[model samples]
Target: MALFKTSNPALGTKTFQDAAARYGGAIDVANRMTLNGTVNRTGILLICAFATAAYTWRAFMQTHDPADVSGLLMLGVFGGFITAMVTIFKQSWAPITAPIYALLEGLFLGGISALLELRYPGIAIQAVGLTFGTLLTMLVLYSSGLIKVTNKLRIGIIAATGGIALFYLMEIILGFFHINFVSINGSGVIGIAFSLFVCAIAALNLVLDFDFIEQGVNAGAPKFMEWYGAFGIMVTLVWLYLEILRLLSKMRSRN
Candidate 1:
């Protein structure tokens, strides 16, 4: 199979190629990867994420203190990053690390969502609805052949994602100098437009992820690839949710 590009670090150009090499070309009948298995694994990861997320959310709701949830937020942020790196380098360990990633990310999401909800009230639920709504819409389009993942489209999405990531990185780096991309991150029209654009890019990355995961299934990758595929999908979902949350925050701040 030819290489393809995606903004998702988990579903990079050679993700399946590397996975294929992990096990020999011969397929294992007992443990061959299937689309259904991948979907099931994804559901499990999502459940794990939401379970931890709910715990953090309840804690914040009860305490009503950002300080109380700061530790969970930090743990989720840093811990998820480390776990993602580990899973990427060692795909076979995805079964172990992917769920951990989901749990840590859930903690992060819960804490951040609690903060946003504290100010914006119903924003977290709105973001969650939009995020999942986008996911289902994309899945239908992908399955119905409405949103074809052409090489050119994939390249465009990957470029846009990389640009967004670089933009965020620059802002983070400049934050230490008491400088940031205020215009883009602010609640102004331009900021809102930027967030909308970013949210769209993040959502479209789902199409890319779906296509890539299906390709893996067709290639008869190993059973463990199910976990890797699920992990990749989860990463995109997390990104989409965060972007939606940011966009909603910007919109709400305007009013």
Candidate 2:
């Protein structure tokens, strides 16, 4: 038969309306993955959120204690391990694993936030507010067509992310060698500027996440892609929140 046909009452039209409809529906479903499959991803995200808040409060309460601060320092390793496991075994951990990763990430975020708050009062709130603000701003820019995500931009983002990750690794190595420089968080004018630059890159990641979801929908990806999409969003949000926390911490130190 032909690729498509129309069922008009008068003359038969060669329009594949049914095929088009099916294709459109698939795309719509993919795009609405988060909304439609909200039960799974949202449950994980909500649990993660609650964990983060609780951990943050616990950290805050113990901010003045040196031993608590020491323990908080270990979050980097713990969170990094969970993230690596998730990424490496995305297939194996698509179900229960993502939520586990989220919880571990929340613990790390909470610890870091608490440490920062101890050093700089009122920074936790600032970081939280800024994270949400940046998210909303990016959403607006994306919807208004002010920002277009291109393949080249994706390449750049991936490259920058790699560079940032490498820098942290180097910092850890230096710490082990007992040759700490400016400060892992940065210091003085140079540190604050660097923090701002990193924060900007984190914000840009959100733009990429938004574009990826839309593209996945247009490409008619399977429904499981919604979980994948939500996972991506969670990663970007976590990074953005961390960057904001770092920036706020720097500002607090300066003041």
Candidate 3:
């Protein structure tokens, strides 16, 4: 049985296990995954994301019109989704698809952040700081063994994440019918509380990602798996950043 599991769909329990089973005997030590390699790949992905994000940010700032970048935003949404699906099914293609995924997400995030920053001045920087702070804090806690990824903790996080995903899906469906979840989406007490809970869960997911990546490194997976591992961490970081942005926006709206 796999000894590690994560709430992150990109880093499922079977991911490393299956990779190890299939590639362990074939790949030599030089071509096997390593912790440092994964970290370096993750940094490269972050740079890729930031690069495109800066472009979209500047474009939006020049026009100051959401309509101007709406097309790019949509492209990022659908393109990133398709690329993520491809990477998940074809893990070997991660070395290529992962950077593409980051770039697309950057487009989406940059447009959204710029739009929000117009409403709440300095909100974008605030969100970025909080996101990285939370990431660093979680890393320290996980590294210090203060936040153990026990079976119970993993299961609980997985269940909570699934529930949140379902809720978001339902919200999207409701939008088709012109239904609005006022209390949950508005800048109210309930909405703020819900955002806080989500932020907490998203941060906890970083711990799970950390644990999952460590397992991948230990399993002697192929070198390409390093890209896949970085992709998984990127997924979690994106989620955490978006959640933190939403929470910050909600709080600012109340002010």
Candidate 4:
């Protein structure tokens, strides 16, 4: 059985195992995944995301019209979803599709962040700082062996992540029927607590992503898997940032 297991759908339990099996004996030393390479690819993807995000952010600021970037936002929403699905199913294509996914997500995030920033000035920067701070803290803990990815912790995080995902999906589905979760979505105590819980879970996911990527490297996954690993980290980071943004917005609304 594969020892690697992560709550991240992008980096499933079998991800490294399957990649190793397929590329076994075919990967040269230079073509094997490396921690440094994955980090570099992750940096590249972040830059790609930031570039387009800046474009949309500036557009919104200049026009002060959501309509101007509405099309791009929708495109990012749906296109990023499709691209992520493709990358998840076809891991080998991650080297190509991952950057595309980042760019699309940037469009969506930029528009949303700008809209929120307009309403709650400085919230975006606060959220960004918290998001990256949590990421760095988690990285330090994980690297120091202070937070071990034991089976129990792994399973707990996975279960919590799944529950959160299901709740969000239900919320979306109910929206079409005109049913809304006012209390949970409002700026009330319940909403704030829920957001805090979600933010914690999202932060824990970064640890799982790190462990999964390390396992991939140890398994000698193909060099392209470096991109895949970085892609997985990006997915977690996006989720973390969005959750932090929501949490900050909720708190700001109370004041």
Stretches of candidate 4 exceeding 4 Å from the true structure? 1-5
lDDT score for residue 129 of model 3: 93
Across 12-122, the per-residue lDDT of candidate 2 in tens digits comes to 121112223444465555344344463367457657765765665586575456466445445644764666455434532445655656776666677667767767878
lDDT of 4 at 119: 97
Global Cα RMSD, each model: 2.3, 11.1, 2.3, 2.3
Instruction: Report lDDT (CA) for all predictions.
Output: 0.89, 0.62, 0.90, 0.90
TM-scores, each model vs. reference: 0.96, 0.75, 0.97, 0.96
Error in Å for residue 42 of model 1: 0.6
What clash count goes with each model?
Answer: 0, 0, 0, 0
Model 4 lDDT tens row, 1-255: 122345688998779878988995797889999999999999999999898888899999998899999999999999999998899889999999999999999999899999999999999899888988998999999999999999899999998988898898999999999999999998999999999999999999999999988988888899889999999999999999999999899899999
Which tens-of-lDDT digit does each residue in 1-255 have in candidate 1? 112356888877677766776673776766778899999999999999999999999999998988888999999999999999899888889999999999999999998998899999999999999999999999999999999988899889888888888888888999999997888989998999999999899889899888888888776778998999999999999989998999999989989
Off by over 4 Å in 1: 1-5, 24-26
TM-score pick, better of 1 and 3: 3
Give the poorly placed runs of model 2, Cα more than 4 Å off: 1-47, 59-80, 183-185
> Model 3, range 1-255, lDDT digits (tens) per residue?
121345787898879878988998998999999999999999999999999888889999998999989998998899998998898889999999999999999999999999999999999999999988998999999999999999999999988888898899999999999998999998999999999999999999999889988988898889999999999889888898889889999999988
Which 10 residues in a row give candidate 4 its minimum summed lDDT? 1-10
